[model samples]
Target: MNAFRTLATIVGGSLKNNATIECDDHGAEFFKVEINSSMDKAINHPDLTFLQGLSCRDSSSSTFGPLTLAQLSHFECGEVALSFCMLHKVGDACSAYYFLRDWARLTRDPKSTLSPPYFAMDSLMPSPFDGPMVSPVVEPKMEGCIHQRFIFSESKINALKVLVVAESCWLSGRIEKLPHLFPNSITMMVLSFSGLTEDPMPILEMLPNLRNLDLFRAYEGKEIISDNNFSQLEFLHLTELEKLKRWLLGTNVMPLIKGLGIHNCPNLKEIPQRMKDVELLKRNYNKW
Candidate 1:
Protein backbone atom coordinates (compact mmCIF):
# COMPACT_ATOMS: atom_id res chain seq x y z
CA MET A 1 0.00 0.00 0.00
CA ASN A 2 1.22 3.51 -0.82
CA ALA A 3 0.77 6.01 2.04
CA PHE A 4 1.16 8.84 -0.49
CA ARG A 5 -2.35 8.31 -1.93
CA THR A 6 -5.72 9.16 -0.34
CA LEU A 7 -8.50 7.39 1.62
CA ALA A 8 -8.68 3.98 3.28
CA THR A 9 -10.58 1.00 2.01
CA ILE A 10 -14.07 0.70 3.51
CA VAL A 11 -14.27 -3.02 2.85
CA GLY A 12 -17.22 -5.45 2.89
CA GLY A 13 -20.69 -4.48 1.66
CA SER A 14 -19.78 -0.85 2.12
CA LEU A 15 -17.78 -1.01 -1.09
CA LYS A 16 -20.95 -1.77 -2.97
CA ASN A 17 -22.11 1.76 -2.24
CA ASN A 18 -18.77 3.38 -3.14
CA ALA A 19 -18.16 4.74 -6.60
CA THR A 20 -16.50 1.97 -8.63
CA ILE A 21 -15.70 3.76 -11.86
CA GLU A 22 -16.62 2.73 -15.43
CA CYS A 23 -16.64 4.50 -18.80
CA ASP A 24 -18.73 4.27 -21.97
CA ASP A 25 -15.77 5.11 -24.13
CA HIS A 26 -13.81 2.48 -22.33
CA GLY A 27 -11.04 3.94 -24.45
CA ALA A 28 -11.32 7.32 -22.80
CA GLU A 29 -9.50 7.95 -19.50
CA PHE A 30 -9.54 10.48 -16.65
CA PHE A 31 -8.51 10.54 -12.97
CA LYS A 32 -9.93 12.44 -9.94
CA VAL A 33 -7.97 13.55 -6.87
CA GLU A 34 -9.40 14.80 -3.55
CA ILE A 35 -7.30 16.22 -0.73
CA ASN A 36 -8.24 16.33 2.98
CA SER A 37 -6.04 18.60 5.10
CA SER A 38 -6.52 16.88 8.48
CA MET A 39 -5.59 13.20 8.17
CA ASP A 40 -8.57 11.99 10.25
CA LYS A 41 -11.16 14.65 9.57
CA ALA A 42 -12.25 14.77 5.92
CA ILE A 43 -14.04 11.64 4.74
CA ASN A 44 -17.17 12.11 6.81
CA HIS A 45 -18.51 15.06 4.88
CA PRO A 46 -22.04 14.76 3.47
CA ASP A 47 -20.93 14.63 -0.19
CA LEU A 48 -18.39 11.89 0.46
CA THR A 49 -20.99 10.16 2.58
CA PHE A 50 -23.36 10.33 -0.36
CA LEU A 51 -20.49 9.29 -2.62
CA GLN A 52 -19.86 6.43 -0.23
CA GLY A 53 -23.46 5.35 -0.61
CA LEU A 54 -23.69 5.85 -4.38
CA SER A 55 -22.42 3.30 -6.85
CA CYS A 56 -19.96 4.88 -9.27
CA ARG A 57 -20.38 2.00 -11.70
CA ASP A 58 -24.13 2.48 -11.64
CA SER A 59 -23.80 6.21 -12.37
CA SER A 60 -23.50 7.51 -15.92
CA SER A 61 -20.10 8.54 -17.32
CA SER A 62 -21.41 11.93 -18.45
CA THR A 63 -22.36 12.91 -14.91
CA PHE A 64 -19.15 11.51 -13.47
CA GLY A 65 -17.02 13.48 -15.92
CA PRO A 66 -17.26 16.94 -14.37
CA LEU A 67 -16.34 16.34 -10.73
CA THR A 68 -14.46 19.52 -9.73
CA LEU A 69 -11.36 19.51 -7.54
CA ALA A 70 -13.14 21.65 -4.92
CA GLN A 71 -16.07 19.24 -4.67
CA LEU A 72 -13.68 16.36 -4.33
CA SER A 73 -11.76 18.26 -1.64
CA HIS A 74 -14.89 19.29 0.24
CA PHE A 75 -16.25 15.74 0.28
CA GLU A 76 -13.08 14.34 1.84
CA CYS A 77 -12.84 16.67 4.82
CA GLY A 78 -13.38 15.92 8.55
CA GLU A 79 -12.49 12.27 9.25
CA VAL A 80 -12.16 9.37 6.87
CA ALA A 81 -10.65 11.46 4.10
CA LEU A 82 -10.39 10.18 0.52
CA SER A 83 -8.45 10.77 -2.66
CA PHE A 84 -10.54 9.31 -5.45
CA CYS A 85 -9.19 8.33 -8.86
CA MET A 86 -11.04 6.78 -11.80
CA LEU A 87 -9.16 5.17 -14.68
CA HIS A 88 -10.37 4.39 -18.19
CA LYS A 89 -12.22 1.14 -19.04
CA VAL A 90 -9.92 0.12 -21.87
CA GLY A 91 -8.13 -2.38 -19.60
CA ASP A 92 -9.01 -4.94 -16.94
CA ALA A 93 -11.70 -3.88 -14.44
CA CYS A 94 -10.30 -5.86 -11.52
CA SER A 95 -6.92 -4.25 -11.87
CA ALA A 96 -8.42 -0.79 -11.30
CA TYR A 97 -10.55 -1.94 -8.32
CA TYR A 98 -7.72 -3.55 -6.40
CA PHE A 99 -5.26 -0.85 -7.30
CA LEU A 100 -7.43 1.73 -5.54
CA ARG A 101 -8.15 -0.65 -2.70
CA ASP A 102 -4.48 -1.20 -2.07
CA TRP A 103 -3.88 2.54 -2.21
CA ALA A 104 -6.61 3.06 0.37
CA ARG A 105 -5.19 0.36 2.61
CA LEU A 106 -1.78 1.98 2.49
CA THR A 107 -3.22 5.42 3.16
CA ARG A 108 -5.26 4.11 6.10
CA ASP A 109 -2.24 2.45 7.71
CA PRO A 110 1.21 3.21 6.37
CA LYS A 111 2.76 0.24 8.21
CA SER A 112 0.37 -2.29 6.65
CA THR A 113 2.56 -4.28 4.24
CA LEU A 114 0.94 -4.72 0.80
CA SER A 115 2.29 -5.21 -2.68
CA PRO A 116 1.50 -2.34 -5.05
CA PRO A 117 -0.65 -3.07 -8.14
CA TYR A 118 1.16 -2.84 -11.48
CA PHE A 119 -0.21 -1.32 -14.67
CA ALA A 120 0.99 -2.76 -17.95
CA MET A 121 -1.13 -1.60 -20.87
CA ASP A 122 0.29 -3.75 -23.65
CA SER A 123 -0.46 -7.04 -21.92
CA LEU A 124 -4.13 -6.15 -21.53
CA MET A 125 -5.08 -6.11 -25.21
CA PRO A 126 -6.66 -9.33 -26.47
CA SER A 127 -6.90 -10.74 -29.97
CA PRO A 128 -9.69 -8.93 -31.81
CA PHE A 129 -13.34 -10.01 -31.31
CA ASP A 130 -12.61 -13.04 -33.56
CA GLY A 131 -15.32 -11.88 -35.95
CA PRO A 132 -15.36 -10.58 -39.48
CA MET A 133 -14.99 -6.83 -39.71
CA VAL A 134 -17.66 -4.95 -41.64
CA SER A 135 -16.70 -2.82 -44.62
CA PRO A 136 -17.92 0.79 -44.94
CA VAL A 137 -19.57 2.22 -48.06
CA VAL A 138 -20.18 5.95 -48.15
CA GLU A 139 -21.42 8.23 -50.93
CA PRO A 140 -20.68 11.71 -49.69
CA LYS A 141 -23.24 14.50 -50.03
CA MET A 142 -22.67 18.15 -50.97
CA GLU A 143 -21.33 20.33 -48.13
CA GLY A 144 -23.92 23.11 -48.30
CA CYS A 145 -25.89 21.98 -45.22
CA ILE A 146 -25.85 24.35 -42.24
CA HIS A 147 -24.04 23.21 -39.09
CA GLN A 148 -25.22 24.35 -35.68
CA ARG A 149 -24.33 23.81 -32.00
CA PHE A 150 -26.06 24.65 -28.73
CA ILE A 151 -25.98 24.16 -24.97
CA PHE A 152 -28.92 24.00 -22.59
CA SER A 153 -29.20 27.03 -20.29
CA GLU A 154 -29.35 26.65 -16.50
CA SER A 155 -33.13 27.15 -16.45
CA LYS A 156 -33.57 24.67 -19.28
CA ILE A 157 -31.36 22.18 -17.47
CA ASN A 158 -33.23 22.58 -14.20
CA ALA A 159 -36.55 22.20 -15.96
CA LEU A 160 -35.34 18.99 -17.55
CA LYS A 161 -34.21 17.71 -14.16
CA VAL A 162 -37.60 18.41 -12.64
CA LEU A 163 -39.34 16.62 -15.48
CA VAL A 164 -36.97 13.65 -15.25
CA VAL A 165 -37.22 13.23 -11.47
CA ALA A 166 -41.00 13.41 -11.68
CA GLU A 167 -41.11 10.74 -14.35
CA SER A 168 -38.50 8.44 -12.77
CA CYS A 169 -40.24 8.71 -9.41
CA TRP A 170 -43.63 8.14 -11.03
CA LEU A 171 -42.28 5.05 -12.83
CA SER A 172 -43.13 6.37 -16.23
CA GLY A 173 -41.57 6.12 -19.69
CA ARG A 174 -39.23 3.46 -21.09
CA ILE A 175 -36.14 2.48 -19.12
CA GLU A 176 -33.68 3.59 -21.80
CA LYS A 177 -33.75 7.40 -21.50
CA LEU A 178 -32.56 7.31 -17.90
CA PRO A 179 -28.88 7.14 -18.87
CA HIS A 180 -28.97 10.38 -20.89
CA LEU A 181 -28.86 12.51 -17.76
CA PHE A 182 -25.52 11.27 -16.39
CA PRO A 183 -22.75 13.52 -17.70
CA ASN A 184 -19.60 15.15 -16.25
CA SER A 185 -21.47 18.05 -14.62
CA ILE A 186 -23.61 17.75 -11.44
CA THR A 187 -26.42 19.42 -13.33
CA MET A 188 -26.21 16.79 -16.07
CA MET A 189 -26.29 14.09 -13.42
CA VAL A 190 -29.42 15.49 -11.82
CA LEU A 191 -31.22 15.51 -15.14
CA SER A 192 -29.84 12.15 -16.27
CA PHE A 193 -30.22 10.13 -13.06
CA SER A 194 -33.99 10.73 -13.07
CA GLY A 195 -36.81 9.61 -15.32
CA LEU A 196 -37.95 11.36 -18.48
CA THR A 197 -41.65 11.80 -19.03
CA GLU A 198 -43.00 11.44 -22.51
CA ASP A 199 -42.73 14.63 -24.52
CA PRO A 200 -45.13 15.49 -27.35
CA MET A 201 -42.10 16.72 -29.20
CA PRO A 202 -40.40 14.39 -31.70
CA ILE A 203 -37.22 14.33 -29.55
CA LEU A 204 -38.84 11.84 -27.17
CA GLU A 205 -39.28 9.34 -29.98
CA MET A 206 -35.62 9.83 -30.93
CA LEU A 207 -34.39 8.55 -27.57
CA PRO A 208 -35.87 5.02 -27.76
CA ASN A 209 -33.66 2.27 -26.41
CA LEU A 210 -30.73 4.56 -27.08
CA ARG A 211 -27.68 3.76 -24.98
CA ASN A 212 -24.96 6.17 -26.16
CA LEU A 213 -25.13 9.80 -27.37
CA ASP A 214 -23.03 12.86 -28.29
CA LEU A 215 -23.68 16.59 -28.81
CA PHE A 216 -20.76 17.33 -31.09
CA ARG A 217 -22.55 19.13 -33.93
CA ALA A 218 -26.12 19.65 -35.19
CA TYR A 219 -27.29 20.78 -38.62
CA GLU A 220 -29.28 23.73 -37.35
CA GLY A 221 -28.13 23.20 -33.76
CA LYS A 222 -31.20 20.94 -33.53
CA GLU A 223 -30.69 17.60 -31.83
CA ILE A 224 -30.11 14.93 -34.44
CA ILE A 225 -30.65 11.25 -33.98
CA SER A 226 -28.08 8.86 -35.30
CA ASP A 227 -29.87 5.51 -35.93
CA ASN A 228 -27.26 3.28 -34.37
CA ASN A 229 -27.60 0.53 -31.81
CA PHE A 230 -26.44 1.50 -28.33
CA SER A 231 -25.30 -2.05 -27.61
CA GLN A 232 -22.45 -2.07 -30.13
CA LEU A 233 -21.26 1.53 -30.08
CA GLU A 234 -17.54 1.60 -29.27
CA PHE A 235 -17.34 5.38 -29.60
CA LEU A 236 -20.23 7.84 -29.24
CA HIS A 237 -19.03 11.36 -30.14
CA LEU A 238 -15.61 12.36 -31.28
CA THR A 239 -14.36 15.82 -30.26
CA GLU A 240 -14.27 18.51 -32.96
CA LEU A 241 -16.49 16.48 -35.23
CA GLU A 242 -16.98 18.56 -38.41
CA LYS A 243 -17.97 15.64 -40.65
CA LEU A 244 -18.33 11.88 -40.50
CA LYS A 245 -16.16 9.62 -42.51
CA ARG A 246 -17.46 6.18 -43.62
CA TRP A 247 -19.78 4.76 -40.94
CA LEU A 248 -17.49 1.84 -40.33
CA LEU A 249 -17.43 0.46 -36.79
CA GLY A 250 -21.08 0.37 -35.72
CA THR A 251 -22.94 -0.19 -38.97
CA ASN A 252 -24.90 -3.01 -37.30
CA VAL A 253 -26.54 -0.21 -35.26
CA MET A 254 -28.28 1.38 -38.27
CA PRO A 255 -31.63 -0.35 -37.86
CA LEU A 256 -31.87 -0.02 -34.08
CA ILE A 257 -31.51 3.76 -33.75
CA LYS A 258 -34.93 5.06 -32.66
CA GLY A 259 -34.10 8.55 -33.90
CA LEU A 260 -31.37 9.90 -36.21
CA GLY A 261 -30.77 13.45 -37.32
CA ILE A 262 -27.84 15.78 -38.04
CA HIS A 263 -28.18 19.56 -37.91
CA ASN A 264 -26.02 22.61 -37.34
CA CYS A 265 -23.01 20.39 -37.62
CA PRO A 266 -20.78 23.23 -38.84
CA ASN A 267 -17.68 21.18 -39.55
CA LEU A 268 -19.38 17.95 -40.55
CA LYS A 269 -17.79 17.86 -43.98
CA GLU A 270 -19.60 15.00 -45.67
CA ILE A 271 -23.11 13.62 -45.13
CA PRO A 272 -23.82 9.95 -45.53
CA GLN A 273 -26.28 9.02 -48.29
CA ARG A 274 -28.28 6.69 -46.04
CA MET A 275 -28.95 9.47 -43.46
CA LYS A 276 -30.04 12.01 -46.06
CA ASP A 277 -32.30 9.42 -47.70
CA VAL A 278 -34.65 9.32 -44.74
CA GLU A 279 -37.58 11.70 -44.14
CA LEU A 280 -35.54 14.63 -42.82
CA LEU A 281 -36.64 17.46 -40.53
CA LYS A 282 -34.86 20.71 -39.79
CA ARG A 283 -34.84 22.91 -36.64
CA ASN A 284 -32.98 25.94 -35.26
CA TYR A 285 -29.47 25.36 -33.94
CA ASN A 286 -29.12 27.02 -30.54
CA LYS A 287 -25.65 28.43 -29.85
CA TRP A 288 -23.56 27.07 -27.06
Candidate 2:
Protein backbone atom coordinates (compact mmCIF):
# COMPACT_ATOMS: atom_id res chain seq x y z
CA MET A 1 0.00 0.00 0.00
CA ASN A 2 2.83 2.38 0.84
CA ALA A 3 4.60 1.68 -2.47
CA PHE A 4 1.38 1.99 -4.48
CA ARG A 5 0.51 5.25 -2.78
CA THR A 6 3.84 6.64 -3.93
CA LEU A 7 3.35 5.27 -7.44
CA ALA A 8 -0.12 6.74 -7.75
CA THR A 9 1.35 10.05 -6.68
CA ILE A 10 3.99 9.82 -9.38
CA VAL A 11 1.73 8.74 -12.27
CA GLY A 12 -1.46 10.59 -11.47
CA GLY A 13 0.21 13.97 -11.00
CA SER A 14 -1.98 16.62 -9.35
CA LEU A 15 -5.27 15.36 -10.81
CA LYS A 16 -7.18 13.33 -8.20
CA ASN A 17 -9.46 11.13 -10.35
CA ASN A 18 -8.39 9.32 -13.54
CA ALA A 19 -7.09 12.23 -15.60
CA THR A 20 -8.66 11.96 -19.09
CA ILE A 21 -11.90 10.01 -18.75
CA GLU A 22 -15.15 11.92 -19.37
CA CYS A 23 -18.44 10.07 -19.52
CA ASP A 24 -21.75 11.44 -20.81
CA ASP A 25 -23.19 12.32 -17.38
CA HIS A 26 -20.59 11.24 -14.82
CA GLY A 27 -17.19 12.90 -14.28
CA ALA A 28 -13.98 11.03 -13.33
CA GLU A 29 -12.84 8.06 -11.15
CA PHE A 30 -9.88 5.77 -10.55
CA PHE A 31 -9.52 1.98 -10.72
CA LYS A 32 -6.55 -0.28 -9.97
CA VAL A 33 -5.82 -4.00 -9.38
CA GLU A 34 -2.77 -6.05 -8.38
CA ILE A 35 -2.13 -9.76 -8.02
CA ASN A 36 0.60 -12.40 -7.83
CA SER A 37 0.26 -15.66 -9.77
CA SER A 38 2.17 -18.41 -11.57
CA MET A 39 3.34 -17.12 -14.95
CA ASP A 40 3.29 -20.57 -16.60
CA LYS A 41 -0.28 -21.30 -15.52
CA ALA A 42 -1.54 -17.94 -16.66
CA ILE A 43 0.17 -18.32 -20.03
CA ASN A 44 -1.49 -21.71 -20.61
CA HIS A 45 -4.92 -20.90 -19.18
CA PRO A 46 -7.47 -21.80 -21.88
CA ASP A 47 -10.39 -19.67 -20.67
CA LEU A 48 -8.31 -16.69 -19.61
CA THR A 49 -8.37 -14.09 -22.39
CA PHE A 50 -5.58 -11.62 -23.16
CA LEU A 51 -7.47 -8.39 -22.49
CA GLN A 52 -9.49 -9.37 -19.41
CA GLY A 53 -6.70 -11.50 -17.96
CA LEU A 54 -4.26 -8.64 -18.38
CA SER A 55 -6.55 -5.83 -17.23
CA CYS A 56 -8.64 -7.56 -14.55
CA ARG A 57 -10.52 -4.29 -14.01
CA ASP A 58 -14.28 -4.10 -13.58
CA SER A 59 -14.81 -1.62 -16.38
CA SER A 60 -18.29 -2.99 -17.05
CA SER A 61 -19.44 -1.56 -13.76
CA SER A 62 -19.97 2.11 -14.44
CA THR A 63 -17.53 4.25 -12.45
CA PHE A 64 -19.92 7.27 -12.51
CA GLY A 65 -16.98 9.33 -13.84
CA PRO A 66 -13.87 9.31 -16.02
CA LEU A 67 -11.85 6.13 -15.49
CA THR A 68 -8.14 5.21 -15.25
CA LEU A 69 -7.09 1.65 -14.44
CA ALA A 70 -3.90 -0.32 -14.00
CA GLN A 71 -3.23 -4.02 -13.48
CA LEU A 72 -0.09 -5.77 -12.30
CA SER A 73 0.34 -9.54 -12.26
CA HIS A 74 3.53 -11.12 -10.97
CA PHE A 75 4.40 -14.65 -12.06
CA GLU A 76 6.38 -17.22 -10.07
CA CYS A 77 9.18 -17.24 -12.62
CA GLY A 78 10.18 -13.62 -11.86
CA GLU A 79 8.13 -12.26 -14.77
CA VAL A 80 6.01 -9.23 -14.15
CA ALA A 81 3.15 -8.11 -16.40
CA LEU A 82 1.67 -4.64 -16.17
CA SER A 83 -1.22 -3.08 -18.04
CA PHE A 84 -2.69 0.42 -18.22
CA CYS A 85 -6.11 1.27 -19.64
CA MET A 86 -6.88 4.81 -20.73
CA LEU A 87 -9.11 6.41 -23.31
CA HIS A 88 -7.69 7.82 -26.58
CA LYS A 89 -8.76 11.12 -25.09
CA VAL A 90 -5.70 10.65 -22.94
CA GLY A 91 -2.96 9.99 -25.52
CA ASP A 92 -1.75 8.08 -28.57
CA ALA A 93 0.80 5.29 -29.18
CA CYS A 94 3.94 7.39 -28.65
CA SER A 95 2.53 8.71 -25.41
CA ALA A 96 1.71 5.18 -24.25
CA TYR A 97 5.31 4.10 -24.93
CA TYR A 98 6.74 6.96 -22.89
CA PHE A 99 4.33 6.35 -19.99
CA LEU A 100 5.23 2.66 -19.81
CA ARG A 101 8.95 3.35 -20.10
CA ASP A 102 8.99 5.96 -17.34
CA TRP A 103 6.74 3.87 -15.12
CA ALA A 104 9.13 0.93 -15.41
CA ARG A 105 12.08 3.21 -14.78
CA LEU A 106 10.52 4.60 -11.63
CA THR A 107 9.57 1.15 -10.36
CA ARG A 108 13.22 0.15 -10.67
CA ASP A 109 14.70 3.37 -9.23
CA PRO A 110 12.20 5.32 -7.20
CA LYS A 111 14.46 8.37 -7.07
CA SER A 112 14.95 8.56 -10.84
CA THR A 113 14.52 12.03 -12.29
CA LEU A 114 11.82 12.22 -14.93
CA SER A 115 10.99 14.62 -17.74
CA PRO A 116 7.47 16.05 -17.63
CA PRO A 117 5.08 14.57 -20.15
CA TYR A 118 4.48 17.05 -22.98
CA PHE A 119 1.14 18.83 -22.69
CA ALA A 120 2.11 21.43 -25.31
CA MET A 121 -0.20 19.61 -27.72
CA ASP A 122 -3.09 20.36 -25.40
CA SER A 123 -2.61 24.06 -26.02
CA LEU A 124 -2.51 23.84 -29.83
CA MET A 125 -5.63 21.70 -30.28
CA PRO A 126 -8.93 23.47 -29.96
CA SER A 127 -10.98 23.05 -26.82
CA PRO A 128 -12.74 19.68 -26.50
CA PHE A 129 -16.11 19.62 -28.33
CA ASP A 130 -18.73 20.82 -25.90
CA GLY A 131 -21.06 17.85 -25.87
CA PRO A 132 -21.69 14.52 -24.18
CA MET A 133 -19.03 11.99 -25.28
CA VAL A 134 -19.80 8.28 -25.19
CA SER A 135 -17.14 6.52 -23.20
CA PRO A 136 -15.96 3.26 -24.81
CA VAL A 137 -13.93 2.26 -21.77
CA VAL A 138 -16.09 -0.81 -21.10
CA GLU A 139 -15.52 -3.22 -23.96
CA PRO A 140 -18.72 -4.66 -25.35
CA LYS A 141 -19.19 -8.42 -25.51
CA MET A 142 -17.88 -9.57 -28.88
CA GLU A 143 -20.01 -12.18 -30.63
CA GLY A 144 -18.76 -14.41 -33.46
CA CYS A 145 -15.20 -13.19 -33.12
CA ILE A 146 -12.79 -15.87 -34.28
CA HIS A 147 -9.12 -15.48 -33.45
CA GLN A 148 -6.53 -17.46 -35.40
CA ARG A 149 -2.78 -17.30 -36.02
CA PHE A 150 -0.78 -18.49 -39.03
CA ILE A 151 2.99 -18.76 -39.51
CA PHE A 152 4.30 -17.74 -42.95
CA SER A 153 7.58 -19.51 -43.56
CA GLU A 154 10.06 -18.52 -46.26
CA SER A 155 8.72 -21.19 -48.58
CA LYS A 156 5.12 -20.02 -48.17
CA ILE A 157 6.09 -16.41 -48.87
CA ASN A 158 7.96 -17.39 -52.02
CA ALA A 159 5.01 -19.45 -53.19
CA LEU A 160 2.66 -16.52 -52.66
CA LYS A 161 5.02 -14.18 -54.58
CA VAL A 162 5.24 -16.60 -57.50
CA LEU A 163 1.47 -16.76 -57.66
CA VAL A 164 1.11 -12.95 -57.70
CA VAL A 165 3.78 -12.60 -60.39
CA ALA A 166 1.84 -14.84 -62.81
CA GLU A 167 -0.68 -12.12 -63.63
CA SER A 168 -0.03 -10.83 -67.17
CA CYS A 169 -1.75 -7.45 -66.72
CA TRP A 170 -0.39 -4.58 -64.64
CA LEU A 171 -2.91 -2.13 -63.16
CA SER A 172 -2.28 1.16 -61.38
CA GLY A 173 -4.38 3.77 -59.60
CA ARG A 174 -4.11 7.54 -59.13
CA ILE A 175 -4.78 9.39 -55.86
CA GLU A 176 -7.93 11.39 -56.56
CA LYS A 177 -8.69 11.50 -52.84
CA LEU A 178 -6.69 10.74 -49.72
CA PRO A 179 -7.95 9.09 -46.57
CA HIS A 180 -7.66 10.86 -43.24
CA LEU A 181 -6.45 7.71 -41.52
CA PHE A 182 -3.67 5.35 -42.62
CA PRO A 183 -4.14 2.00 -40.91
CA ASN A 184 -1.53 0.08 -42.91
CA SER A 185 1.94 1.63 -42.97
CA ILE A 186 5.45 0.14 -43.21
CA THR A 187 8.76 1.71 -42.19
CA MET A 188 12.30 1.51 -43.57
CA MET A 189 13.52 -0.53 -40.63
CA VAL A 190 12.20 -3.53 -42.54
CA LEU A 191 14.73 -2.87 -45.32
CA SER A 192 17.70 -2.31 -43.01
CA PHE A 193 16.93 -5.63 -41.31
CA SER A 194 16.96 -7.54 -44.63
CA GLY A 195 20.80 -7.24 -45.00
CA LEU A 196 20.62 -7.04 -48.80
CA THR A 197 23.52 -5.24 -50.50
CA GLU A 198 23.31 -5.55 -54.29
CA ASP A 199 19.88 -4.17 -55.10
CA PRO A 200 16.43 -3.72 -53.49
CA MET A 201 14.47 -4.48 -56.67
CA PRO A 202 13.82 -8.17 -55.94
CA ILE A 203 12.19 -7.50 -52.58
CA LEU A 204 9.97 -4.84 -54.14
CA GLU A 205 8.99 -7.27 -56.87
CA MET A 206 8.07 -9.93 -54.28
CA LEU A 207 6.11 -7.95 -51.70
CA PRO A 208 2.94 -6.12 -52.77
CA ASN A 209 1.14 -5.64 -49.47
CA LEU A 210 2.77 -2.39 -48.40
CA ARG A 211 1.27 1.05 -49.14
CA ASN A 212 3.81 3.24 -47.34
CA LEU A 213 7.59 2.62 -47.31
CA ASP A 214 10.25 4.52 -45.40
CA LEU A 215 13.69 3.10 -46.27
CA PHE A 216 16.56 4.61 -44.29
CA ARG A 217 20.28 3.81 -44.41
CA ALA A 218 19.84 1.20 -47.19
CA TYR A 219 23.43 0.58 -48.41
CA GLU A 220 22.45 -0.94 -51.75
CA GLY A 221 24.79 0.07 -54.61
CA LYS A 222 21.94 0.87 -56.97
CA GLU A 223 18.17 1.05 -56.43
CA ILE A 224 16.56 -0.26 -59.57
CA ILE A 225 12.79 0.23 -59.50
CA SER A 226 11.07 -1.42 -62.44
CA ASP A 227 7.69 -0.35 -63.79
CA ASN A 228 4.70 -2.20 -62.27
CA ASN A 229 6.47 -2.09 -58.86
CA PHE A 230 5.04 -0.40 -55.79
CA SER A 231 1.78 0.24 -57.63
CA GLN A 232 -0.09 0.91 -54.41
CA LEU A 233 2.52 2.93 -52.56
CA GLU A 234 1.34 6.45 -51.71
CA PHE A 235 4.16 7.60 -49.46
CA LEU A 236 7.90 6.96 -49.99
CA HIS A 237 10.92 8.08 -48.00
CA LEU A 238 14.61 7.32 -48.57
CA THR A 239 17.43 8.62 -46.38
CA GLU A 240 21.12 8.39 -45.55
CA LEU A 241 22.59 5.90 -48.06
CA GLU A 242 25.78 7.14 -49.77
CA LYS A 243 26.26 3.91 -51.74
CA LEU A 244 23.02 4.60 -53.61
CA LYS A 245 24.70 6.17 -56.63
CA ARG A 246 22.01 5.54 -59.24
CA TRP A 247 18.25 4.98 -59.35
CA LEU A 248 16.31 3.50 -62.27
CA LEU A 249 12.58 4.09 -62.16
CA GLY A 250 10.36 2.36 -64.74
CA THR A 251 7.21 4.06 -66.06
CA ASN A 252 5.11 1.46 -64.28
CA VAL A 253 6.99 1.75 -61.00
CA MET A 254 5.46 3.70 -58.13
CA PRO A 255 2.73 5.39 -60.18
CA LEU A 256 0.85 6.72 -57.14
CA ILE A 257 3.40 8.02 -54.66
CA LYS A 258 2.03 11.45 -53.68
CA GLY A 259 4.49 12.09 -50.88
CA LEU A 260 8.22 11.60 -51.48
CA GLY A 261 11.19 12.48 -49.26
CA ILE A 262 14.86 12.01 -50.18
CA HIS A 263 17.69 12.99 -47.90
CA ASN A 264 21.47 12.60 -47.29
CA CYS A 265 22.23 10.70 -50.51
CA PRO A 266 25.08 12.66 -52.06
CA ASN A 267 25.66 10.04 -54.77
CA LEU A 268 22.09 9.63 -56.01
CA LYS A 269 22.29 10.33 -59.73
CA GLU A 270 18.88 10.26 -61.45
CA ILE A 271 15.16 9.86 -61.11
CA PRO A 272 12.62 8.48 -63.56
CA GLN A 273 11.58 10.88 -66.36
CA ARG A 274 7.94 10.58 -65.39
CA MET A 275 8.88 9.74 -61.76
CA LYS A 276 7.14 6.46 -62.61
CA ASP A 277 9.51 4.97 -65.20
CA VAL A 278 12.58 4.64 -62.97
CA GLU A 279 15.91 3.48 -64.52
CA LEU A 280 19.47 3.68 -63.23
CA LEU A 281 22.92 4.23 -64.79
CA LYS A 282 26.22 5.47 -63.33
CA ARG A 283 26.91 9.13 -64.17
CA ASN A 284 29.05 11.90 -62.62
CA TYR A 285 26.22 14.41 -63.19
CA ASN A 286 26.06 15.18 -59.40
CA LYS A 287 22.40 14.13 -59.11
CA TRP A 288 20.85 15.92 -56.18
Which numbered prediction scores highest in lDDT against the true structure? Answer: 2
Stretches > 4 Å off in candidate 1: 1-208, 211-228, 231-249, 271-276, 285-288
Worst 10 residues of 2 by lDDT: 169-178
Off by over 4 Å in 2: 1-37, 40-66, 123-288
Highest TM-score model number? 2
> Model 2, range 102-121, lDDT digits (tens) per residue?
77888888888777667556
Candidate 1, residues 242-262: lDDT per residue as tens digits?
343323323444453333444
**Counted clashes in each candidate structure:** 42, 17
